[model samples]
Target: MTMEDKREPKRRNPAKTQARILDAAFELFSSQGYARTGMREVAERADVATSLVVRYFGTKAALFEQALVRAIYERGFFVRSKPNFGERMAALVVGDEEARIPAMMVLAIADLESREIAQKITRDVVLKSLADWLGPPDAQNRALHMLTLMNGFTIQTRHLRTGDVPPESVRWLARSLQAIVDEENAPVN
Candidate 1:
């Protein structure tokens, strides 16, 4: 095959290439922390040129922001998928290391502090969606409480990486969250 023909396979598909770059940035930022990671490292890991990474994302901060947005988006934090979702989410917090919620929390806390865009996404996309799923009249308050607990659980499992959290504790946490779900669905007096 001609060299030009061989090189043709590597041509960028805009969506796919962008996804790959985001995936690479997510992994690197999660593992290394955002400040420590660089655009070149993300490019190398994504197997794309640094220029391409910059071309798509402009700045390292923008890349990191997009990565964060993608992670939150993937969790479907606002969508009510099923009954007992709190239990399911709690189970996920315990079991799904690859979910990266814990790592994302660290990134927000450590690097993205004072970034209005990040705050806006968290407040608008995540918090609002979660509150909406819980439904009114106390939905926002309930969501805030649940998020606090959920984040705490994620930190314990993902960041602390402590030996298996006691199964009973997991069960209790799930049950607590389940109670909230039950309340949300309960008939009004």
Candidate 2:
């Protein structure tokens, strides 16, 4: 009997494989954007067959949406209290490079459908949740303002390659965001 014949083939776990694929997809999409990221590249990064990626995700858009949603939820941005929301957001924008993925995705994707998906996720999931958490007295508008501030800051930091944001700058940004949350400095509407 040949020794090679006795070896057992590796078992496949669908759930783990899907998770790995999603993680790989998120990494690629975030770094390369949807237009530049390919399914084969995702499969390669996940260390799986390209056919498996297509079978699981169906299309690049579907995969992009799923990966983006998963990344957003994993961030847990909405779980924090409103009292220090500004400070938390400012810290994320200034210090957490990983936290900038959503904004990066939004700016980087050029394809119409993929761009729409990114925008929709940003508005529907992120904006809606933040507005809901803020609650009343122009919560929607305030949340929009907060998102704009954070997104703009994220882009600026990335483009300018600003390292180690000054403590005073962070504090200033925090105060500006906190003012929006507090609604004390909001203009009459």
lDDT of every predicted structure (CA atoms):
0.76, 0.81
Q: After superposition, how far is residue 162 of candidate 2 from its true place, in Å?
A: 6.0
**Residue-level lDDT tens digits of model 2 in 80-149:** 7768888888887776566556555655557888888888887888899888877778888888998887
Expressed as tens digits, the lDDT of each residue in 1-189 for candidate 1 is: 888876755454899999999999888877667778889999999998999999999998788878878977776655756576767777777775544755665555666541455577668877787788878658888877777777777777767866878888788778877777667667777
Candidate 2 segments exceeding 4 Å error:
1-4, 162-164, 184-189
Error of 1 at 96 (Å): 3.6
Q: TM-score of every model?
A: 0.84, 0.85
* C-alpha lDDT of residue 115 in model 1: 49
Clashing pairs in model 1, backbone N/Cα/C closer than 3 A: none
